[model samples]
Target: MATLLHLDSSAFHEPSVSREVTAIFRKEWEDRHPGGTVIYRDLAKEPLPHLTADGIVSALAPVDSHTPEQAAAAALRSELADELERADAVLIGTPMYNFTIPSTLKAWLDQVIIVGRTAGEGGSVAGKPTTVVAARGGGYGPGTPRESFEFVTTYLEKVLTGMLSLDVDFIIPELTLAKSQPQMAPLIDAAEASRAQAEQDAVQKAKTLAERFAA
Candidate 1:
């Protein structure tokens, strides 16, 4: 049976574009694989602790020499990384905050990025398909004035691909604040279009990956 590791880090539940988009993708995936497993984590609700120096040192040193605190941290890191290693596909939903991903999501990344374990040659999860839904309040696509400030996708692309060697793709719903912010009122139509396209992409991508895994 296929396993999917799904993560959502949006603080807002009711009106979060990233959460909504990710939900669409998850539903499609679940529908296609009734017996499949989905390992879900809501980072906003149950935040992971920021990676400590001890956690990093524990990975480098022998496990038998770990202090109690280092051992605990190491265990947590291993557990988190194991989820990724077990997954056939991975999904991350993170709304942009101040032009970057949420701290909760970053913490999750830090905990799971064990250099010798998950971030190097012959890593357990290398080449896994990772879909990231990066919802943003404003447009930051290429050629946009804010494109230079788009750290969410740029940073994640490097980390997910360069560090973990995962095959990464992104589904972005931009201009999420169009309806809420009066200054963005004129962009409501454009925002809706982006949302619609993102939802469509999610469903299609999820279905394709589901079939690929089921094969």
Candidate 2:
């Protein structure tokens, strides 16, 4: 049976666009693979520690030389990497915070992006299909005034593709705050349309991935 590693980092619960879209993808995935396993991590609820200097040193040092604290940090990193290594696919729900991913998500990435374990020639999750649902509160697509401010998807793409060598796909829902913010009221229609399209694409992508991995 296939195993999917699912990560959600949205602080907001029901109202979060990223979470909503990711739910669609998860539903489709579960429907396709009823017997498959899903390793779910809600980063917002259980935040990971940011990489500290000690943790970095421990990751590079030999296991036998690790201090108590270093060993604990190394263990956390290993656990995170092991989840990715065992998964056949990955799904991430990330809402843009100040034009980038939340600190919770970033912390998780720091824990998992180990050198030989997940980044180099022997990367465990290399070439695995990874889908990222990136939700932005404002419009930052190409030609938009804030286009250059969009860093969430770009940063994730670079790390997941450039570093880990994963086959990454992005599903973006823009202007998610349109309905909630008075200043964005006029853009609500466009936001809804974008959300609908993202949901549809996520479902289709899930089906395609399920079939590919099932085969």
Candidate 3:
């Protein structure tokens, strides 16, 4: 059975655009692949500890009789990396916060993107497909006011692609905060429609990759 790793990093619980969109993607994916298993990681709920000096030392330290804290930190790193190795697909849920991703999500990335694990000299995560459900309060597309720059989408795509060799796909739900946009009902409807279309697109993309590999 295929394994899908779902990660949600939005701090805004129910009103979170990223969370809602990702839920749609997950449901549709499950519907399409009955036996697929999904592993959920909620960064907001379970935050990873910030890297400490000792932790950094431990990370650079050789694997030996390490302290309990060091061992635990190391284990967390290894576990996160292992999850990537095990996953057939990864779904990332993120919302722009001040033109960047939530700190919690970046922290998680720091944990998993280890040298010689997620990427390194010995072929790390060379072929994985990752889908990102990204949403913003305002428009972030070309020619928009806030579109001048945002590092969240571009950075994630670049880092994930380079570190994991992941075929990245992104769904950007823009203009949610636009006054010209419709009311709550229509806004929700539009978001739902965008999510539906993105889900189909992601599945087709992954299926095509799978077919190519199988061939």
Candidate 4:
């Protein structure tokens, strides 16, 4: 049985465009795999703490901890690692805030990307595949006005691949703000449609890889 860890970072709930698209993808995934289980984590609702200097030191410390803070930090690292260890796949719903992911989500990333857990001193994500669903308010793909504003995708791929050693699949919904403006719905709709198409394509790719691995 494949276990999927579903993470949502958008502060917006029902109306969050990113979550909307991710929800669709989640439904499709569940339908395709009837017995698959999904573990949902909402970063916006339950924000994770950023890595503190003390936390770093504690994480590097041996399990023999006398201080309460050190013990807590060590426990936190282990818990986060266990989450990744238990999951067969990960799905992230991200809203582009300030041309990047939400701060809360970043906090969670800090916790999970621990040096001996998700990766070692050499670096590798010894877990499973991670799929990201990114939502942007404006056009920011290959050749749009905001094409240069692709820092989010570039940074995400590099960090997830370089630091975590995880296979990544990205699906971006561009021009998400278009529908809110009467003059831009058509353009946004087109972008959204493309995003939806990409989701299906990515899912199919993942399913193929999964089946091949099972075989």
Candidate 5:
């Protein structure tokens, strides 16, 4: 059966666009594969520890040579990597926090990426399909005033593709705060349209991947 590693890192669980979009994708995928396995992690609820020196350095030495701290770090890294390796696909819900991804999501990336293992050439998850739902409070695409400040998609694209060798796609729903912020009432309609498109895209992507993997 196909397996998906799904993660959500939105701090505001009550009204989170990224989380909703990812859920749409998951539902479509589950509909396609009733027996599929999904490994879910709500990063905000149970955040992983930030990557530490012990974790990085542990990759350099023999497993037996690791100190107690390094041993623990290495074990955690292995567990995360194992999950990624077992997954047939990956999905991440990351709301833009200060123009970038949430710290919890960053922590998950840090722990899951290990040089010459989960990352680098011949990485365990190389070319694996990954879908990222990047929700932003405001418009940040090209031609926008804050386009230069947009880092969520750019940064994740680099890390997930350049470092981890994953085949990545993104579903962006911008201006998520337009409805909540009175001053941006003009953009509420646009926001709604963008969100609708994102959900549609999510369903399409999910079904396509599910069919491909199930074949």
Candidate 6:
């Protein structure tokens, strides 16, 4: 049976566009593979520590030379890497914060992006299929006023595709603030349309990917 690694970093459990869309994908995936395994990680509830100097040194140092703290840090990194290595596919729910990914998601990336493990030659997760549901509160697509400020999808694409060599696909729900912020009231219609389209895309993508991976 296929195994999926699902990560959600949204702080809010309800009314989160990223979580909503990712749920659609996950539902479709589960429907396709009823007995398949899903390893879910809620980063907001159990956030990972940011990489420190000691953690960095421990990751590069020989296992035998690791101090007690270094060994602990190395172990955590190994666990995160193992999750990615064992998964047949990955799904991540990322809500844009300050125009980029949440710090919790960044911390997870730091833990998993190990040299020779997930980066350069012999990378464990290299070429793994990954789907990212990126939700942004404001419009930041091409030609938008804040286009340059959009860093969430761009950054994830760079790391998952460029760095880890994962086959990454993105499902973005834009202008999510339109429903809650008074200033964005006029854009609510467009935002709803975007969200609806994203949900549909997520279903199709999930089904297709599940079949491909299960085969």
What is the lDDT ranking, best to worst? 1, 5, 2, 6, 4, 3
The best candidate in terms of lDDT: 1
Q: Could you estimate the TM-score for every candidate? A: 0.98, 0.97, 0.83, 0.87, 0.98, 0.97
Q: Each candidate: RMSD to true structure?
A: 0.7, 1.0, 3.5, 2.5, 0.8, 1.0
lDDT score, candidate 2, position 141: 92
Tens digit per residue, CA lDDT, model 6, 103-158: 99999998888887788776778889999999999999999999999999899999
As for candidate 4, its clashing pairs are 124-164, 125-164, 125-165
Backbone clashes in model 5, listed as residue pairs: none
lDDT of each: 0.95, 0.93, 0.75, 0.76, 0.94, 0.92
Per-residue lDDT of candidate 3, residues 110-212 (tens digit): 8887776677645467767788988876646777566677778888988888776777888787545543455544466555566566566655655654444
Q: Candidate 4's residue-wise lDDT over 1-215, tens digit each?
A: 67778899999997887787677767766766678777888999988788776678887777675368877866786787777778777788888988888898888778888886677655434546788888888778777878887777888888888788888888877777887888786797686786677667656755654563341
> What's the lDDT for candidate 6?
0.92
Q: What tens digits encode model 5's per-residue C-alpha lDDT throughout 1-215?
A: 99999999999888889999999999999999899899999999999999999998998889889999999999998998999999999999999999999999999999999898989889889999999999999999999999999999999999999999999999999899998999999999999999999999999999999999994
What digit string (tens of lDDT, one per residue) describes model 1 on residues 1-215?
Answer: 89999999999999889999999999999999999999999999999999998998989999899999999999999999989999999999999999899999999999998887899888778999999999999999999998999999999999999889999999999999999999999999999999999999999999999999994
* Candidate 4 TM-score versus the reference: 0.87
**Candidate 3, residue 85: how far the Cα is off, in Å:** 0.9
| Model 2 residue 151 CA deviation in Å | 0.7
Clashes of each: 0, 0, 0, 3, 0, 0
By the TM-score metric, which is better: model 3 or model 5? 5
Model 3 collision count = 0
Model 3 segments beyond 4 Å from truth?
179-215
Candidate 5, residue 194: how far the Cα is off, in Å: 0.2
Model 2 whole-model lDDT (C-alpha atoms): 0.93
Where's the lowest-lDDT run of ten residues in candidate 3?
206-215
